[model samples]
Target: MVDWSGGNDRGAVPKADAIWAGVARGETVEDPVYLRNRKIAEDWIGAFLEDELAAGRRVLAGFDFPFGYPTGFCAALTGQGDPLALWDWFAEQIDDAPDANNRFDLAGQINRDLVGGKGPFWANGLKRDVPGLPRRKDGYVNPFPERRLAEGQAKGAFTCWQMAGAGAVGSQVFMGLPVLSRLRRRFDAAVWPFEPLSAPIAIVEIWPSLTVGPAPSGTIKDAWQVAEIARQVAALSAETLTQILDVNAPEEGWIFGLGFERLLRGTPAPLRNDCFALPTGVHWTPVDEAMELLRSRLSPVTGQETVDTADALGRISAATSFARRANPPLPNTAVDGYGFAGGRPAGAQVLPLVQGRAAAGDAPGAVPAGQAIRVLTGAALPAGVDTVILQEDVTVRAGAIHFQGPIKAGANTRKAGEDVVAGAEILQAGRRMAAADLALLTATGVSQVRVRKRLKVGVLSTGDELVDAGQKAAPGQIFDANRPMLLAMIRQFGHVPIDLGRVGDDADALRARLDSAANKVDAIVTSGGASAGDEDHVSAVLDAAGAMALWRIAIKPGRPLALGMWQGVPVFGLPGNPVAAMVCTLIFARPALGLLAGADWEEPQGFDVPAAFDKRKKAGRREYLRARIRAGRAEVFASEGSGRISGLSWAEGLVELPEAAMQVSAGDVVRFIPFGSFGT
Candidate 1:
């Protein structure tokens, strides 16, 4: 496996972003070889191949660059759709040296002379301006699609048009294809998906990121990726390797291990740490940064239970479920018709009637040649019969049936395993089962499933100024809305809600309530007194007991969050205000509780809708506004005040604005997340 680079050479010392190659033979893998430049890398690869071939070994070499552009690009460039011809064309046009190349010039020439447009390619990363190459995609237009079919299948892969930005692979395509073409010609190598994988040497396109994982300490990431992929690929069985290469991508080449990436996934990520602890230097975490920390540090805390499939609705699956039996389970007629050994007929045809009839749950029977038997819908097709003619399409006569000409085989027949195959994965782990899922599982003969036990989450409210609703309020006391709201929200999140009720601003009382709730529930949600204020008994009590750690998240409406553990139970201390408390729970606690309850940590699904209002947002903090989608556009609340409790009822969801300074005009697309998507 070769990690290709398109940049200038580095010095003799090994570094990242330089070309590196890893070789594997059987179960053994060699240390990655760092090549300083493209020319040197090509020479080194050629030498390695020659040595291997001379020793009578068949070699499969993989390079991390796109082997072809989008479907129509090669035809537009070379008057043909052959990717190999495009590779040769690139080899003819490009010039390479240790420090420089004509890749930018060739890209410009192709854009102007061949395709006759400004771009599909852009972002010339050169100091000097290159003709026909733009620095940004703001106004660029392309005659062809920006991505290939493989790019759509693999998430986060950049289009080949992006040449000079972070994660761009276009430069590598321009510089690497020529070398590949030359190597193919010199070694008579078969380029995968274009030609059969039957040769002494086979070359394939690869994207290393598909199988990348954490690198070991003191190991270069590029080197680790190449070495790991090489070892994994070399260890694949012949049948598995053949399956991985069996993709229909002749025009636009496929990534070598696109679908079979698990074979290359070196190791699983470790489980979450024992406590909610942030890194030492992290003071105020950005929204994305905080989420990444949580994703890497959190795992399931609940145990699994076996439940009947009929009782599995709204429960998280503990493991993936496979179909015990196919949905149809046998070849069956799709309608009330005659089953017969069907064949193509030029005109009308007639078949003699058989002695018996077939219906649902009938024993297996056979039909004589040129004979038809009466069959009903859901009836298994009798032996020696492969087709059925609909009753409406045929005429029943004396001991015979008549049908029209040009009748196709297998018409109106439901084949076995058509809807679902036995032993195939039917339900994934971490899925929250619903009514439809139960029906599917029952149909596939999955009687019971392993599911996670529901998490018991307790809700508590602090501060002396709050009183329960429906009670006569004293002076300066407001009704306690956070507890009821939080309790309901917890139930909506598919967990058992335990109301811990209210506690005053006394530290002793707060500690007692937390201790008692810790023994009763799996986790606690406290909505008031989470900060370091004089009346913040919750944080002070947990902190004095060495259980609290404050997280200053850089998000609007919700900034200070207190996370801690008491008696082995996690506590999420949200803001005292109602709006901030709700937002923080939806944004952070929902996914956190999901992880603790044995479900996958999932972000709320968001959609891009046009903005109905205009605003200017500043950097350094992410902001989410209470908003609703109306007529395909998202409109925020009239007020940004956190005290406006009515706005929560008025809006359907939240419009999330990113942490960047930009002017959002009316009709600009903005990301909107519905409250229902977060299960609230």
Candidate 2:
């Protein structure tokens, strides 16, 4: 056994040396020396014990020397017995002892004396109080005082009692119990009453087991390689330990039987549980089961009703070719120029004898030959004027205007109805208002235009376990998160959200709310109360009110979802889980609302990226895993729990696992749906 107190000089002590020399030579020493050696060995042994136990080793068997006495009495037997038979006779004297502590104290004292005292044998180079020692001012005294100690007393004192017996009893008892039980079960009475135990027989059975194969018999780069090997060994050992400790272990026959039972339950049958095997047959769904209950209830059985698109915008125009009513109805100049009669001579100078200045919307009389009218941009053209020469091309001399350049026919002229004919179609029906559209409509003399009415969506939430945010939750209640998340989703899709508040688990209340909302809004959207659970009444209400349809999609975190209509009003019932509700609303409800509102429906955008780590998944279900995209790679977040909303906040995107995949390997191609794309 290795001495753990080497730094403290316990191994260098004469008594400890003698015991170690004896053990090295395969000889047993006296009780005092042997006990002292074992005590020193214990410190090294304890550190290894935890590792050994976790590695599936029965450490207690090696530590407990005398079989059943908590702390082995082998050293005590060695005094009057052959060293080889020390452990053999230990059990006989063990019954005479009062308690385990007594044996522990005996062992502790042996170690204390070997390593203690300020004698010449103290190899630790420290002083300790002995039977007769000069007392220092600090209460401790050195029996064999050093030259340095006399010069100046050391600040701290050392004591042997503090090291011995500190944790010996606990260590001995803890290590002994499991080993003794295993030995008793294996060798029975032969290993018990360990008195008269033969040294050769004990060595043959135990020495090889405790040796640890000479430190793995090889060199390692550093502690890390050794640690990794130890970790693997520990993992394997833990599995074995679990098997040994397990009570009521499962039987192979019973396992097969349970599996067979599940197989029968999963198989569709009249062939199920039949003694003779029958050919597989397709099971026909009942007519009622074949039909979608929710969809059928909400289906519009009647033909198309006279639904009118009426709101603030004006009525639709009947004529396909409608003309623009002239804005400022008159002939107006498009540029500042002189309005004069035709047949003016080339480069001819004219007097500025202004006939009259014509401003926009002003009426002026006709201009005769040799006379020019001053016209500002957008000013009405004077009567009988065929053209206007720009000011830059004419010069004013005295009271007359002189032509600086030759004026051409129809110069600076804006032809009537150039922008739009008086009777041209400005805007068609169903056009939504934009700034440019408004300007065009006003130009066409349209005060109001026809546009599609915005769809009003009624929203509600149902669950008895829900409470409003910032309110104290009662037993079994959780603060409502789905409602707020759903509301945000609705508003993001550009539809008006009319919150109908929340309803409890009661079916009647849900029915009343649904009926009222259906009458007022174009569509109804709700969260929760859509599962097959006892409290799920939304489906039942939909059935009672009208036709409806529900679909159990092959998607993770959102399998249970319903999409239907009530009295021609589309209805969507989302699951209660906050994450599930949010994801489903974004994928299905948002697009549906966009379609109903006459807006273009676009799929949520996602990017292809490499998965940062392995992802385990069930086959046949599409999974949307929350992940963080960093450095252009997708990394999965810690919380994958479908019910945890914080996961959504922590995630930068969602990694979509396809339906057919059972697992995603690291660096595999994955679709990373950025949260920003979904209006996060």
Candidate 3:
């Protein structure tokens, strides 16, 4: 446990005897002094408990001095023996305090014994033992050293008394001092002396033998391994030590009580001390090694061919420009109207006899004078007609039309080639097809188009402990998930997914599969068999068949990935874990596939969002945590464990944490990448 004292003056540390004596005699100090002392005592006790919690201890019982005394003493004097009953009474007293400061001090004091040293007084883990005491003993006693509390009296009363009996309680208050008396019982059980409580100290048990094995005497291979071990130790210590300090430490020593139990449980012993140090000079050649091995294998060659446009709707394709013109050239009326000769009819009142009706697509003919032709919308106009009068403007009377106003020439009439002229450029080259493009092409009477072919991606899964989805799992086998996921992802990228199925852990089997896939597909993807496990055969197979490239990216959940080429086709080997495999595929494989497919892809869209809670992380590593957006703020899923598949399932997006920051506070702005950005 990592516990420490909080106040500047030693007197802030509670003396069980003084508290018990005051309670027993019914002698209360002035409200100001009482409030100040209680605060100091509570602060010390809370710190001690927090340290224990950090060390990973479960507290069974806890005790506080004067804060718990009044109720416990009153109960004892009244013939009550139940500890819980005494605690309840003490809680009521603290809650009933007049002001917030007093209430907090009392709450801190009472909580020291109730909630395992956690309450209002000392942050999240510390428990206050008194709500009415000063925050610091020295601060209360000496407002200013230059101006004494009294002309002759020593101004350092609080500090002097605190240091003198820092860990001991006076004999006068022995009976009523619940915290000290309880601590005495605990020490007796541990075989530590209960006397000499004035040592201004706390006693913590070091259980290195139980929590962690003896310190390692040999060297380790990597820094990560050492750091991992340290992390485990720290987690264990926090749980164990928290409880011990909260329940068993003496009031006076409460501020100083903190310790951890380190037990080593595996074959290799754990490193000792509070931290682990790993060697820093180790060098790696992952990329070079992968490439060297791949270069030795021969690649298969194949001829490329083109596919028709209709079949390439959902596939990647090369684009080309096309020029075309509309058929059936002729001038026609754009709207329903009557065709007349010249600009307008002279002498508007004069009546013209009705002639033949000219509808759309009708053969063109000459227009006679004193004759009006009834024309419908889109109809071809007669050779001599230059103007059209809309049907709405003319009224029929006695089988003849009577016009109220003159009609303008060429009004409501469509000219030849108005929309698209002959041999016009309809579309440019290298453009992807859209709904509008299809309509325009059909309208131009074009029947065919040129486009590029879609790239085919082959997906393979390799592992001895893997089984197909339909099969039942054996004792140690798990179902393969990477292949299906990769296939779906490939499809989403507008590429063909060529499933190679599952291969055994054998290197020859994997190599044969890769060899066959390389000949048929433009790219290959494999999951698992990338790590340096005893049975890992991906690297070995790649080396035997083609050139490979590996990257040690500075990102979490996808660190162990291999990018290489098999017979000129790119091969991406993702980590076995579902989360890591998915992340690596998006970061590396997706972009490569886009390049091959002739799509101009850009980085995923991200927005700034406020974090909903505090988050702790290590520096120097970029972390992407699955999160959800609520009210424009990013909230992380409750379970963030890498192995918890449910965590991903519950997340609607991802939060990108940069490498420079080690911790994230509530309301801090973070970059949020919605799941839609990944095509999910």
Please report, in order, the local distance difference test score of every candidate based on alpha carbons.
0.86, 0.49, 0.51
Best by lDDT: 1
Query: What is the Cα-based lDDT of residue 98 in candidate 3?
Result: 17
Q: Taking the candidates one at a time, how many backbone clashes does each contain?
A: 0, 23, 55
> Across residues 105-152, which tens digit of lDDT does each residue of candidate 3 receive?
443443354433332122211254344233333323211122112112
Model 3 residue 458 CA deviation in Å: 1.0
lDDT per residue for candidate 1 within 487-581, as digits (tens), equals 99999999999999999989888888888887788888998888889988777877887767788999988898988878777888999989999
Task: List runs of model 1 lying over 4 Å from the truth.
Answer: 1-274
**RMSD, candidate 2, Å:** 38.3
The regions of model 2 sitting more than 4 angstroms off are 1-331, 337-353, 369-371, 384-394, 400-415, 450-454, 484-496, 530-536, 543-546, 552-560, 577-591, 594-680
Candidate 3 deviant stretches above 4 angstroms: 1-311, 326-432, 531-535, 543-546, 602-624, 627-636, 647-680
Candidate 1: worst 10 consecutive residues by lDDT?
265-274
Of the pair 1 and 2, which is ahead by TM-score? 1
Candidate 2, 1-680: lDDT as tens digits? 22112122234434422212112111111111232333344443344444544665442122211122212222332454232243333222222211122323332333344334222121211244433221222333233222221112212212221222321222232223333333333333123123222221111111111212222223221221222222212222335433422322111000101112212111111211111111245132222222223212221111111111222232222112234465445666778867876646655666555645877767757776667878888876777776787777777767677775466666777766667766566554323334565556566565433223456788888998888999999999998887777777667655567888899999988877877887788778888987667787887766555454456666777876655556556677889888888777766666555545544444569988987878778666677888888877789877667798999878887888876756778788899988777655
Question: Candidate 2, 216: how far from true, in Å?
Answer: 97
